[model samples]
Target chain A: MAQPLPPLSRRRLLRGLLAAAAVTALPSPGGLARAAEPLTRELPGTGEALPRVGLGSWITFNVGDDPVLREECTAVMAAFFAAGGRLIDSSPMYGSSQATIGHALERLEAVDRVYAADKVWTSSPAEGPAQIEASRQAWGVPRFDLLQVHNLLGWEGHLETLQAMKAAGEVRHLGITTSHGRRHEEVERIMRRVPLDCVQLTYNIVDREAESRLLPLARERGIGVIANRPFQRKRLIRRLAGKPLPPWAAEINTTTWAQFILKFIISHPAITCAIPATTRVDHVRENLAAAREPLPDDAMRRRMADHVRGL
Target chain B: MGGGAWWSYRPEDLLMFSPRVYARLFELHNQALWPAQLLALALGGMALVVLLRPGPRGTRLVAMLLAVAWAFVAWAFLWQRYAPIHWGIAYVIPLFGLQALLLVALGSLGGGLRLPGHWSVRRGLALGLFAYALALHPLTALATGRGLSGAEVIGLTPDPLAMATLGLAAAAEPARRAWLLLLIPVLWCLLSWLTLDTLGDRRAWLPLLAVIVALAARLWPRAPSPG
Candidate 1:
């Protein structure tokens, strides 16, 4: 016969542990910066300045236990940090990606430079806290700067736990995430109801469903917006590869297709960050370079959108 | 980008690793099991000989050899390696283990398999598949502009190993539970096909083609026994 086990839910168990441990500020091991300070946006209400460009570890960082691939990922992270980029987002669902990030940070010794962001992804409410804790252990962080309810799965329970964690200072901010223009209605509803510090959604130039409602709501609510899949996971870049960049793109100082797409996302007033995941060091540098000054104004933004749309 | 409908999700949408990572897995797996790859080929050769000729001792030997291959793949490739990168692989690892146990049971307990007594279309097709898995399949790496290190060797990688097992099962004369041996390998082939297809690799057709040939061989008429 199996035991029923303790009645304590994972959230409560985590809360108890949080109460016992002293919440210390994460150490900054700075001095990797080699570029001018990249453009940054303030996290809604917290006044925390986050680099407009962040590194995403989705398909790019899930490189198993292979030492070579792990080192390659570390090099990408090194380039990202060297360019004055800060926020690095990952999730439990990304399979070994968090561990890879931890490996990179450990190798680079730039944990201080990274604004660690992760997500709670399990549908089981009781499993949410444990997952977040495991992710924290994977990233080797004291606590994540932001923890989001991934794709709105079991958002009710995970959101409540995140709010509790935020109040307890276990996490600095709480938010929800959706990708590929998914579940916008529910995402918008949560933005209205919850005191979210940020919201992450798929907002590349092609997939702009969030523009009409979610982006506006995020701005109105003072919630920082993170634009994910800025290059549609490299599909958009591949699509625009052979096509010549519009001559007007030079007006915004965009030179490549990646810089064009990333600039369009970060230039939005509501978007606090654009996380473009990559496996190459050169690509990481190019992504961070897009965050430099001379961003696209409203007219240029429309022109950029139209140019890609026409292409 | 379709409205988050579960059905709307394509195979590529679920793939969390890149083709480069997938190729690297094989290269590293091949590197770790260096001399053992030669042993894997030897075992495959032994199985091929047994497949072409029908005898109780040889049949049992082939089954045991397949059992070894399945067990090794379950532990080394799927469990130790792939489970970390692709979390869903952990669930399928046990299926490989179960297939190994089934092969062991078939080898020890006997009577489930019925090998053809003489040359037939099925036997020829079986030999073809064995040859493909053991030899031709690995060359796909070189053909696709990848290094020999990423070759899908029989008994080492799942795709070729599954193809070889399906070949062995197809060569056997129809039996009550012999189809059990084909079940997991067949499913694995379909899955491999989906994964490769999702990656947009043309080699996706290789596994799918193996399935079609294996099934056809299974259904092919057995030659008449000696009078």
Candidate 2:
């Protein structure tokens, strides 16, 4: 026989707990600024000052069942902002990244300063609404700052909804994105026809296919460019492994292979920001260095490109 | 997974000049499990609540809760970028959390401990403490340096060794320390996850072996019986 318990709704307790957790998750004003501190490299966008370095949530923070890692990853995010960094990009396909961001940021309290960007990766009309809602819930924001169609995930009708979101002020920006090398031409074709504000794709030192058309076209269209995988899946590390750091690499304040790669990506005038995701505090520190100072000029960019290509 | 092996992964990695991810995401979520994904998280949360006990159950419950949300977030946002990585650990956290509440609910109406009103700062403190433990995990990974989305031993799967190590470390008062045993499973999940997923498939297999070692150690005979 068990003792009788008082009457109270467990759901209410959960809601209360969630609310409390959310409050706990929200960063302090200083902590929020601190979180964005590392990402303070502002890119000269169409008009607004955007952080030159941002975080990519494609794969780093998503470790199933490792809530500890998620929290650590969230701390890494806080550390990013603390280091003058800002601009984090995520999408629906990047499972639970949005949710993780919400969970982690809910307690931080000062999350408003941080750029909250995620995507809707869907195709069905109903699915689009649900995804946007889900992303909103996961992000814990009523509306998103930038709601993109993930990898061109739900390009047609969802973009239509995005257009509405932009019109109604539910979102500040709307666009389509892709990452495959072979999809460049197709990506280019769509960019030509679509009313887009931003473009994302892989454009690291070793993989320079985007430079041929997508990048140049972005400049022509006045689209703000965001670079991703500046390191090419850490291929640069694999490339530069066992090799000494270049003498000139340190000239731009690059200490590790991570900075060198990130610097190279943002060097191009067309790029607004380069988002490279990392879970380690050290890597975040290294990546933030790219946004701190001027990137290598075109001449240096060419030399770096050639250097890595040769490697 | 849609992207090529090179740098063709991650939604943010691509330029969305004329993006299509919106439509694609819609198609993906509408098919079947999208709605359930959120529910799974809820259920997983519930499981954690149910499984966590004041003595040994309390810590294990908390560990499971931490594992569930962490894994769900990881699968949703980072590692399984394209789809949900369905596994027992993934669902168990919330499942057990909810189950715990259910037991209390049934046990209470049918006769149990009286429930407390509004969660006070005490619960908040507990959460903060739990979050502290979660935050420390990456340090373990960072110390190892091999920590990444795919690093083994401390993922969704429970590493027996990690659990035992954690269990033994907290073994002074097995009741209060039993939850430490959960580290074994959490570490095991992390270790096994290394091979199953990673920043990319190209990551070295070192974490895989580490996870195996952790699991073996957990299975080793010991005084405390870690569930």
Top model by lDDT, which number? Answer: 1
Docking quality level of the chain pair in candidate 1: medium
For residues A1-311, could you state the per-residue lDDT of candidate 2 as single tens digits?
A: 99897667864554444445333333457746444333332322435467778888765655433445556666677666656655788876665567667766664443675677787776665688787888888778767777777766647787889888788888877777776455676678778888787877777787787888888998888777777767665556877988766788877777777778888877777888888877676677667756656468888888877877676
Q: Write the per-residue lDDT of candidate 2 for residues B113-213, one digit (tens) a residue.
A: 22122233333333332322233332343443343322222223232223322322232122323333334344444644543343233322433444444
Lowest lDDT block of 10, candidate 2 chain A: A35-44
Q: Write the residue-wise lDDT of candidate 1 on A183-286 in tens digits.
A: 88889888899889999999988898988999899989999999998988778988999999888888888899999999999999999999999988778878
When candidate 2 is compared with the true two-chain complex, its DockQ is: 0.04
Name the top DockQ candidate.
Answer: 1
For candidate 2, the TM-score is 0.56
Q: lDDT of each model, Cα atoms only?
A: 0.85, 0.55
lDDT by residue (B41-115, candidate 1, tens digit) is 888887787677768778878888888889989999998888888989989999999999988887558464668
Fnat computed for model 2: 0.05
* Local lDDT at A15 for model 1: 41
